[model samples]
Target: MDFSRTHFELFGLPTAYALDRDKLDAAYRELQNAVHPDRFAAQPESEQRVAMQWATQVNEAYQTLKHPVNRGVYLLRLQGIDTLDASNTKMSPAFLMQQMEWRESIEDARAGKSVTALDALSDELRAAHRRIEAQLAELIDAARDFAAASEAVRQLRFMDKLIAEVGDVYEELES
Candidate 1:
């Protein structure tokens, strides 16, 4: 229960992008059970405070490891790379064009109140997300190319926002 341990170490997981979700879930549950503050209800104030701190750390580490994007960012941070750096915002023109097309599609579908088109766009974005995730795994785990991985992470983050906007449009159309 060393606080200095990385999230992967805390979950007894490998320091890589590809992960076993079930293993992470199990480890999180086990750690939560061990450090749950309620178990220290009868302890001294100092012990209770320590339990609270451990619980918070365990929860934070579990969250960071649970999601693919957060996990990727954590991996990059561990290697001294900042994925959110402003200078890293530069993307290829082709990707920028693709992003614009997706935005236009969302706008058109929303304006038309076309649920079918929105669903199709959502499916396409999901496929793109999967492909990018595989790329992230390769760059981070197999290639060990943190620099390229950081760019891929930025792309993923953009995809996430686009996906969210699609969802927002769906909600608007629903109304």
Candidate 2:
């Protein structure tokens, strides 16, 4: 239980994009059981405080490793890269055009109260998200290409926001 270890190291998993969810879940459970604050209630005050810190670190590590997008960004960060920096806003032209088209479709669907159209767009975006995930696995796991994986992470961030917006529009239409 090294506090200085990265999330992947804490979970005893390889430092790659493609990870086994089951392994991560099991490791998290084991770590939580060991350091959960409640387990240290009768200990000395200093020990309890240290346990609380360990609990916080474990929870943070679990969260960062649980999500695909976050895992990718964290992996890049380990390599001294910052994907979320405002100045690092360089995406491909093709992806930008695709994003614009998707945005337009979402706007049109919401304006028309077209749940069916929104449903179609939701399916399309999901498929695109899967494709991007696959690309990220290849770039990060096989090629070890952090540069490409960084772009994939950025694209994934956009897809996540758009998907949430589509869900909101659906809720509005339903109401």
lDDT of 2 by residue, 49-74 (tens): 99999999999989999887998899
Model 2 poorest 10 in a row by lDDT: 1-10
Candidate 2 achieves a global lDDT of: 0.93
lDDT at 132, model 1:
90
TM-scores of the candidates are 0.97, 0.97
Cα deviation of 159 in candidate 1 (Å)?
0.6
> Candidate 2, after superposition: displacement of residue 68 in Å?
1.3
Clashes of 2: 0
Highest-lDDT candidate: 2
Clashes of each: 0, 0
